[model samples]
Target: QQQVRQSPQSLTVWEGETAILNCSYENSAFDYFPWYQQFPGEGPALLISILSVSDKKEDGRFTIFFNKREKKLSLHIADSQPGDSATYFCAARAYQGGRALIFGTGTTVSVSP
Candidate 1:
C-alpha cells in the first residue's frame, strides 16, 4: 500500500482558467503530504503542502484539497498562466527516514494563450 498516482500525463489549460491535477495514494500510514511544481529544466520546489491531520492547504495561486478518508487529493492552480506551465508532483512521507517522499506519476500542465 505504498503508491501515489496522478492523472493526465499532460494538460493544456488556458490562461486565467483554473487547472486541476488529481492524485491519489493507497498507503494509509503516510502523514505528510506535499506538492511540488517544476518548471522546464528546473528542480521541483515545494509549492504547497498539507498534513494528514488537515484536509486542505493553500499558498498564493496554488491550493491543495485533501480527503484523508478517500486517500485522495488535488492541486488547484488559480488564474492559470503560460508561465505556470510545468510538471506537478504529489508526494507523501511514509517512512521517517530520509527520502521519505513517494511521488505520483506527475501531471505536466501547460498553460497557454
Candidate 2:
C-alpha cells in the first residue's frame, strides 16, 4: 500500500490563478513532509518542506499547509504561470523512513496564458 497519496492526477490553470494540490499520508511516524517540483527531462527539486511542529510553510509563491492530527497536507501555488507548469510530488520521511523515499503519485500541472 502507498503510504502517501495525492489528489487530482493532473491540473490545468490559467495564468495568475492559484493552484492547489492536496496530499495525505498513512504513517503517523512521519514527521517530515516535503513537496517537490519537476520539469520535463529533469529530476525533482525540493520546493518547500514543513516539520510536524509547523502548521504552515511558505517560500515566495509556494506554500505548504500541514495538519498533523489528520495526517494531511496541501501545496499551494500562488501565481500560476506557464513557466510553472510541471509535476508536483508529496513525500514523507521519518527517522526510520529509510534511504528510499516514500512518494505519492504526482500531480501534473499545466499553466496557460
How far out, in Å, is residue 52 in model 1?
A: 0.7
Tens digit of per-residue lDDT, candidate 2, span 1-113:
99999988999999999999999999988888889999999999999999999999999999999998899999999988899999999998885745557889999999999
Steric clashes per prediction: 0, 0
Model 2 RMSD, rounded to 1 decimal: 1.2
List per-prediction Cα lDDT, in the order shown.
Answer: 0.89, 0.93
Q: List candidate 2 segments past 4 Å from native.
A: 97-99
**Pick by lDDT: which candidate is best?**
2
Candidate 1 Cα misplacement greater than 4 A, ranges: 95-99
How far off is residue 84 in model 2, in Å?
Answer: 0.8
